[model samples]
Target chain A: MDLDSQEQILKLSELHGPSQLMVIIGAPDPEAAEITAETVVQGDPSYAGVLAGAQLGLDVYHVLDESISSEVPPEVWDAQIGVMGDVLEADALVAAVAGMRQPGSDSS
Target chain B: MLEGRYVIALGERDGISGPAIAACAEAAGAKVVFVATECFV
Candidate 1:
């Protein structure tokens, strides 16, 4: 996004280490948001599943509902929704890579 | 074992550490939150 936001993300990424990756997805309703999170967490090719499949070596955490409010920043949350929506709609392998790459660029 | 602690384990999906950590957390009377890069299909 902006230079400051980008810098913030990069700085936070460095401070947090590479082991954790958090994605925040928002929906029209809390229920839908939670469902989306559950899908990412529990789906056959879940967020974690796709990352492992790609050998990314990073842990994936899905933030939804109250977790979103507590855990995600507004800008990064918006970026995650945009990226995750694309991932959910596309082929698993390709989307996974794209999903992994988005945060790396935008956040990490 | 993390007793009375809120534990968040970051682990690899292809490995057993995530679940093992969760189990250990449980045994230690800790609340566990597990996040992983991948998981078994």
Candidate 2:
């Protein structure tokens, strides 16, 4: 990582807060990143912060991580209930599509 | 029977897996990413 990249990561790390988020790259496709970016742009804070940290302009190297956290203080990630389970703390979404009815769930 | 919530796959060790996640996100009105945790053993 270079100095500019380092700085951006630091900034985002400060913004992301505590409760480390695990962002999965999923298939190494640029589309995934784009979806993430789109989510950040449209989503609220919960999913925004973490997603912000993982924004890799052109390269995946452009992400916030421990390397830059040292220069900043850990914050708390305020996770919110997006359209569904897609949280800002987790930019990489993993959904389990169940029908409107199940054994023990809310479908009202 | 109800289809319920579709279960997308996320790789182990907090790494990337298949495109399932992205697909789910798009389907679930995800602007960025969605999360679905399930265990199949």
Candidate 3:
């Protein structure tokens, strides 16, 4: 990664104290999801810490279904089930929905 | 508040809602370690 990216990661890493783990879930493009995940995984002290002490871990989950719309992807159900299982095991859960605007909705 | 805490973020990748939520979580002191998104195609 570049220096800018590394700096951002470092900033994010400082947010968590000890004994902290976070799980993020979203859907649509897998690449974007992975990027976000890497930010935490590679930014955390435990995962990327060059020091001696232990570090925390970040868990990322990318769903294939769109939660904002009524239509469901063919494989989303299974993915949801699996993600739910992971959520239950996580210390905390966060739902990141980028664009929540519905179809045919006014932008104004 | 969210210091040393775990969080789960859920949303879509088509717009600003997903990332916005994640940003909010982080702003609230929650570490967004994981990310999952639904396919728009």
Worst 10 residues of 3 chain A by lDDT: A99-108
List the TM-score for candidate 1's chain B: 0.56
lDDT of 3 by residue, A8-101 (tens): 3344446653235444444333345444444444442333343213122343333322321113232443333434434332222223312321
**Candidate 2, B1-41: lDDT as tens digits:** 00222222232213332343434333433232223322223
Q: In model 2, which regions exceed 4 Å deviation?
A: A1-19, A40-108, B1-41
lDDT of 1 at A7: 35
Candidate 1 fnat reads: 0.00
RMSD of each: 16.1, 18.5, 14.0
Worst 10 residues of 2 chain A by lDDT: A93-102
A1-108 per-residue lDDT for model 2 (tens digits): 122323443344345431222222332223443443333223212343434444322211111222212222222111112222222223232221111112332221
Candidate 3 lDDT by residue in tens digits, B4-33:
455555455443244544554555455566
TM-scores of all candidate predictions against the true structure = 0.24, 0.20, 0.32
- Which parts of model 3 have CA positions greater than 4 angstroms off? A1-9, A23-27, A43-57, A63-108, B1-16, B19-41
Off by over 4 Å in 1: A1-108, B37-41
lDDT of 2: 0.27
Q: Which candidate has the highest TM-score of all? A: 3
The CAPRI category of model 2 is: incorrect
* Cα lDDT tens digits for candidate 1, A1-108: 112322332343345543443333222233333333333333323333322223322223322223222343445444433344343322332233234332432232
